[model samples]
Target: MSPDQIVVTVIGLAAIAFIVWFFWLGKRLGVKVAVNSSGYQEAMVLVKGGYTPDLIIVEKGKPVRLNFLRTESAACSEMVMFPDFNKSAHLPEGETVAVELMPNQPGEYEFQCQMGMLRGKLIVED
Candidate 1:
């Protein structure tokens, strides 16, 4: 009945809407990167409900660097692991952590959070 209550309700609805829309739209939108002059392909992935550009396509036999930025303070998003690469990094809130990987073969490599709730795939192509 109060203006304050109305504002709070509206904000809550907006947050829910954002979450739904993000998951729905993010699934189809993936970023591709090619090896730059620096000898690596660069891509920025956001860690929220999951990794943005949830799928990344990179050239095989080249290096790719994923710059992961953790915007959420959730504990689950604090750590990212790439089992196939034998690599893992602790992602601090509001900081961008770079994970460089070189794949000599063509295949799909998976990355995820500590809890395995967040998943991402990297497709290596010739």
Candidate 2:
């Protein structure tokens, strides 16, 4: 291939890779967890690339307590926001932060970092 063809091929590959990663990352990192006896569904969410185990599954009409531990110092993961609940929290480096909420409806609730790069979801189901 010529120099221009090589460049075009490289760019095309990069775009395809990004598209696949962007769509699959969420499902790849998702984890379904049940609340423990202590009434909390806990997970350690790594914040470097995004929230690990981003998808959290739970029963509907029940109060949910989520603990997020941010292990990275990236500014993009400094804070977590739950727009559905009107909740936002600052996550200090290397600490576990708790978010308590009562989700009475069966739906998908989204959470993300301040810059919206790190993303998470709570799937409330029957």
Candidate 3:
């Protein structure tokens, strides 16, 4: 192969590797919900390119309140959905929307944008 062709091939391979690592093999960000004075678990998540701290930890059988602050106006991120909980909320840009759910069982529940482009997980533990 020509030298220029080899360089281009290597760059293309590198870009593909980066995409794989970023979207699949990368380390995920997580946070543990804090119990507020009212006794409900709460977490504040920033919504931009995706949900910041995309993983949340909470106890089973407790109420969880997630405050999502939408910082971007992306159409794909305009709504957040928790299918397992049958809960969803509209996230307006520059506003904080609260989504509440009660996790009755210990398991992992998925939350995602309306288009499923942005995703997160809620882990409930005994």
After best superposition, candidate 2 residue 99: deviation in angstroms?
A: 1.0
> lDDT order of candidates, best first?
3, 1, 2
Q: Is candidate 1 or 3 superior in TM-score?
A: 3
**Predicted structure 2: lDDT:** 0.80
**lDDT per model, in order?**
0.90, 0.80, 0.93
Q: If candidate 3 were superposed on the true structure by all CA atoms, what would the RMSD be?
A: 1.1
Candidate 3: which pairs clash? Answer: none
Q: Which has the greatest lDDT?
A: 3
Q: Model 2, 2-101: lDDT tens per residue?
A: 9999999999999999998878853444576677787765556666678777888878766777777878778898899999999988889888888788
lDDT tens per residue, model 3, 30-61:
79887899889999999999888899999998
C-alpha lDDT of residue 61 in model 3: 84
lDDT of 1 at 104: 90
Over all chains combined, what TM-score does candidate 3 have? 0.93
Report the lDDT tens digits of candidate 1 across residue range 44-93: 99998889978999998888899999999999999999999999999999
Worst 10 residues of 2 by lDDT: 25-34
